[model samples]
Structure formats: structure tokens, C-alpha cells
Target: MKSMRAMNVSQPRRIRIANGQGFWGDSVDAPVRLVEEGPLDYLTLDYLAEVTMSILQKQKRRDPARGYATDFVQLIDRILPSLRTKGIKVVANAGGVNPSACRQALVEVAEEHQARGLKIGTVTGDDILDRLEELIASGVGFENMDDGRPITDVLDRIVSANVYIDSFAIAEALARGADIVISGRTTDPGLVLSPLIAEYGWKQDQWSLLAAGTVGGHVVECGAQCTGGNFSRWWEVDGWDRLGYPVLEFAENGEFIVTKHDGTGGLVSVDTVSEQLLYEMGNPKAYLTPDCVVDFTSIQLAQDGKDRVRVSGIRGGEATGTFKVSIAYLEGYKATGQLTVSGPDAVAKAKVCADALWGRLERAGFTYEKTITELVGLDSCHGQIPGPPPDVHEVVLRVGVKDGDRAKVDRFGKELAPLVTSGPPGITGFAGGRPKATEVLGYWPSLIPKDRIVTHVDVEEVQ
Candidate 1:
């Protein structure tokens, strides 16, 4: 197979990019099915989330070889033969907090499958955990974008800090002949857009084209979301048992068609695509990304077929000189405990059980920064907005508390088990043991100048 650089430079009329996995825990079979089911130019998988990076950091701290998403390695092994035979290159941000470790694992997998001559490229330098002190000393405030609080307040408790990188390094890897590109902390859309940029040779200053690619990426970033998995009118969707992930047939001019495999179940319509476009979106007029500032409001969507949607007319502005940073720090500790309350008047009994638990905590001179009590089967989701709760057969009593004192949170966990035996006649479901206090990691969003960071791309053959 020729490298992406040696591919036809005239640009194909359309390129199909498929998203196999959405988040870290998405179905492992999705990628395998994506490669085996139909035609694809690139298979992009997104595995990193703000909390996921922190979890990976904790794993790396415990075992140096275990930080990256291990599922990605397993998935690659499952699809290695198909990927090689079909000449389908892969781009993924499954490295989480450690791209080097992820690349090493892929090398081992390639060798295991006897898939010689496989080039794995890794993009690193997004992680800035060790440089936080130096950056702060250099006047990078690292303030919380939402609250405007300096990171110095929680510097001592920081576990992981990674800047959201763009697609330039990923494109560089593909151009350098990497069959699989692994990136740490790259933006989700960048995983999809990188392949487009590499194949089309889109210039760095192509704001509108970059924005159009970003829009296309955002539509399919969540895997099956744009394919009717989370659609509002889910009843209209077909083949619920075997829903297919999304595929983007992107044109050189930035127009794209959203669809799924030919025989797959799932609906791809204007409504489904629009829902995904509006998801996690802020300021519809100015959607900021590392490569460009996309205007989601200007996008045009149309239902072109039974399960196909065409998206076009996306406009964008020049990108800012800054990159968003995701930082996680230990705020304190929290523990939650739940008990199933059955029999008549279940809701009333559950409320009493919650009050008793907190009362016991207060009696023991324990106070938490926050406390939450909810009836799981009743008003948990809508809170008080749904009016008075309906009378149900049973409800789960859930009590959660967060505090700086771990001992207090631990004490709260002990309160729930006792309630199972002593509080109410119908209380049960405490077989899971006491809910242990866990470190409460808080998210800190900020931005740093793009010039302050440097991304490195390296490709090596698994010979």
C-alpha cells in the first residue's frame, strides 16, 4: 500500500471517513464491524474525555505500561487483517494520557498478528502535567475559565493536564506513512479532520475549508449519535438491535454526506444530524476549535435519502492563537450509597431513610460541603420540575456527600448499610458492601497560547 503522501494529489470527488468508537467505553465490536461491513477511507476512534484522562493518569502512576486505552489495542488486533487488506488507515486519540505507551502496545499487536511493515505513528507533547509549575512561574495563570479562579489554588492536587491539540500533527503522521496514528489529547473532531487535511492537502490557513471539515467531524464524532442512537424520535429508527456507526463522505469543497453501512440498522436524517450538531455546542455563531472557528448556525442540512443526510454551507472564521486545556485536580472526597426501598409507601420510607442518615452524620459532628438525596425512581432526573412525584411500587434511596474530610465521607458510607437492617422494614440491597470514599476530581478548563506548546510526531515500522 502506498503512503498517504503518494496517493493521488488531484483529490477524489469524495472521501469516506467513519467513526467507530465514540468514548472510551464504546462497544469494542463497532470498529471491527466498521472495517468489515463496508468501504472506508479512514477509521477514526475517539477515546479520551476529561475524566478519562485523569483515570488514565492514575493507572499510569500505578503501572507505567497501563495508561492508554487498552481496548484500542485489542480492537486493533481484531481488525488488523481487514485494515491491512482493505488499505484503511486509522486515526485515533485513544492514547489518553500516554501516547507512547499506546504506540508501544500497537507495535506488539502488529507483531503478534505477523502484520509486518505496519507503521505506527504517535503524536505527543499534549500532556503538560510536569510543566504546570514552570508555566505558572512564566505567568500562565491557568485560571478556571468558568469561575476565573487561578490553578494555583489546586496546583498541589492536580493529577493530569493536557492541552487539546489540533490535526496538524496527525496530518503530519499520515503524510509520513503511518498506517495507524495515535494521539494524546487531540480534539475529537481533529481525529476525523486530520485525514481530510492529509488527503486533500488543505493548507493551514484554509479557514472555511477547515471549518467545513470541523463541522463534518462534529457530526460523526459521537459514533452512532448522528446515526439515530440518541435521536429524539428513536421510535422511527430501524434495526435497533444492530445499529451502525456513522460515516462521512466528505467532498474536497467541504460538503459531506452522513450515512451508515448499507445493511445496518439506524436512521440518518436531518433531525438526527442536527441533534448531534447542537450537542455540547456553545454560542452557535462562534464554535471555537484548535484549527478554526466554526459557525454551527450557518450549517445547512438536508435529508438526501432514506438513511442519508447531506451537510453543507458551513462557514468559519480564522482560528484563535490559543488552545483549550483540560485539567483535573483532586477537590476532596465523596461517597454515595443507595438502598432499595420496597413495599407500600416506598417513597415516604425512602425519604425518612435519607433524613435519618444525614441526621446521624450531623449527630457525629460531620458536615459535608454538599449533600444530595434523591429518590431514584421518582424525581431524580427532573428534580421538582415534574410536579409531585407519582406513587410507585418502590424507589431507590440514594444519598451522596462531598467534603474535604475523607473520614466524614467514609462515615457517611457506613450509615447506609446500617439503614438496611435498622432503619425501615423494606430496606435492602446492601450486598455490595460499604461505599468507600473516593477522591473527587474536579475539571478545570482554560486556554494557553498555541505557540507555548510544541507537538511531536514520530512514525516507526513494526519490523
Candidate 2:
């Protein structure tokens, strides 16, 4: 930890940070637009989801150098020249389960772009899948945070286990002159929070500043969410075609303004920012992070201007000694098949089709551990409410099955197409072939002692 005396710079230096991506499949053009459309000091991207690690782990098993987000490499190829010209830094968690592989890909992209003197930092050590047995022997239980089950129960089926690391390693990478930082399994807020820690030289004990930065990170972490993409009042928001991603104007006093680029789309009011604040939040009083536990209830929001909201009055407490661990395992196999049922009695015909499919499967001695049948137009979203089936022109009959036996699930797929010919009238939409059984991955959340995890940062310069 570097002391404030070593910083030796003027106080109250503000920076502009914008988030271009919210998740793995976010718009590919948003990141490039964020860089080219406006002035930005830092660009943060997030690419991992809870089940993303398992998917990436499977990819790495097939190919040694293929686990990270490939989109990030291509995005960098498009934006490297602008980033270098603008003197802008980038921080992202596109590393997935393979930071080294991601680093290599980024190096290749940089070389292809002919970008020189760029320091790419690779942050590692969040992965603990190989150390599970050793940690268990050393008295780490890895108990399920939800059901309190021991991890030994599913040890053989476990595919990925990563701890949610903090932002300090990223800050260290920046301090070491890294122009871009790549990390694995970092908390989404840490992507933005790390740059604040690095640029402001905030100490670990500054809970208020850390909490403020964490809130700032959370607001823009989802990209357009704070800028009215998923706001409850969608009708109130304008410019859906060109919605601007969220940007933060962070200051040294632990206050930041959330806004979008002038003349760009998307609305950034208190309501939109408030809606994003509660997204996936558990406890308002103690929003836990690796750096500190924030008091979200103590925070205040006000409209600073059009498409701008000011956030202030945040308080925080000390961080817990344990870090949350995301563990994914192979649950079983699942397959789904759907058919569009139309005409006089679409709902009734769909129901009959579902019943016939199940009866045929039972007669063939193909029983599954679980099965679901839904009439897409009727009750797929909010499971069948108390009401007569709405009279509709057409309804899609979707059926799925999950079981430990792959053969059974595959056989279940074979049953759906037969329904179109034999079950009910006016059944179509089977153009897409039978659904093949796919691996079903389950998530297990756990906790690990913070001391058990040690993160490393390596900064390499492009020649």
C-alpha cells in the first residue's frame, strides 16, 4: 500500500469513467462508441456471469488457449488506436477462467494493431479449483452459502471455483503503469472501483471513499441500466435505438455525478439510477464488497441536471474476513422442444399435445427426474395465474426434460416431433430439428477465508 505522502500531487483531481459493457453478450458496438463518441479517462467492461466460468472452463478443456472472452480481443483491436491517442486506460474482467490465455490474445491484438508501449496487466490467483482439497485439509469447509451443504458432496462433479476478489490488485496494476487491466472473477463494481483507488490514491481504511466508489461502480457496472435501459418506466425513456451507456464523473470528495454523453440517447435521472441501485442487492444496510461493506441505506441521490444524477452521503463499515466463492458443477442433462399450435382451440390443442407427449414417454419407459410443459403465449413468464386460458389465435407448446441419464433426455427430444403428426390438429413449427440433450450446470455459492486467497498482477509492455 502506497502512502499519501508518496502521491505528492494536487488534491481534487476528477476523472471521467464510462462502462461500455454490462455482460458477456452486450452490444459489440457500445464499447467502441463509448470511446469514440466522447471524452473518457477510463473505460471499464464486464463480461462474466455466474455460469460463465463453467462455460469458459469447458472451452479451456477443449483448447488450452481458448477460455477468455474473444470479443474483448476484437474490441481492443478496434479501439486500441483511439485509446492510445486519447491517453485513456481500460479495466475489464474478460479473463474468465484463463487470464494467461486472455493476456496472450490481447498481446496478439496489440501487435496486430501496431500499438506500442501499451502495458497490459494480467491479474490472477482467484481460481481455487486445484487447491480445493488442500484448502479443505487446512480446515476450509467451503460450505454452501444457501443450503449449508458441504462441498465434498459434489467434489467430483465440480468444474469451476473462483473467489470474488477486490480492486486493490487492479489498483496495483495501474500503479505499475498498466494501460489496461484484465482480471478473472472480479466483482463487477471492482472494475470501476479499482481505477478510483489507483487514481485517487485512496487508502484501504478510507471506508467512506471506498463505499462511494463502490456505489459509483455499481451504478455504471451494468452499462445502460443506470442510463434507463432496464428502468421500470420504460415509456418515460427515449432514444432506445441509440441508448448511451452510463458514465461517472468522480471527484476526490467521494461524490460522483452519473450521466451520459451530451446529445446522446438514454435518460439518467434519479429514478433510473435508483432502479439500478437495487438490482441484485440483498441487504441495504450492509452491501458487502471485498474492499468494504457499504451502507446503501445511508446513501442519497439527487438530480444534478438533465441526464445527470448526483450521488453523495454514503457511509460504510469494515469488510468481512471471508470472500464469496462461486462454484459450478455438472447437474445433469436437459433438452427442450417446442411446437406452434394454432387454430380454433389453440390453448386446448396445446394442452392435449403436452399430455400426449408425456403419456407416450411414460409408455416407452422413459421417465425423467423433472419435466416442464408451457404454453408460451399463455403462462410462460408468470406461471399460470388463476384464470381461464386466454382466447388467443396461436400458442407455442414448449416441453423440456432433465434427468441424470443422457439417453432418457435424448429420447425425450425424439418424442416432441412425433406429437406434430399424431397428437393434435394444427400443430406446426417443428422446422428446427429435435432438441439435443445438453449438459446442465448448477451454481453453488460458498465462502472462503480472505487470507486463503492471494492475487497477483503482471504488467507486460508491447514491444
Q: Candidate 1's residue-wise lDDT over 149-219, tens digit each?
A: 97878888999999998889999999999999999999899998899899999998998899988988888
- Each model's RMSD to truth, in Å? 3.4, 4.1
Candidates in order have lDDT scores of: 0.91, 0.92
The residue pairs that clash in candidate 1, if any, are none
Per-residue accuracy of model 2 over 1-463 as CA lDDT, tens digit each: 3667456454456689999999999999999989988889999999999889999988999999998999999999899999999999999999999999999999999998888888999999998888999999999998899999988889999999999998999999999999999999999999988999999998999999999999999998889999989888899889898999988999988899999887678899999999999999998999999999999998899998799899999998898999999999999999998999997899999999988999988999988899999989988999878988678999999899999999999999888888878977899999778899999998999999899999999999998
Each prediction's TM-score versus the true structure: 0.96, 0.96
TM-score of 2: 0.96
Q: Find the 10 residues in a row with the least total lDDT in model 2.
A: 1-10
Judge candidate 2 against the unseen true structure and give its global Cα lDDT, from 0 to 1: 0.92
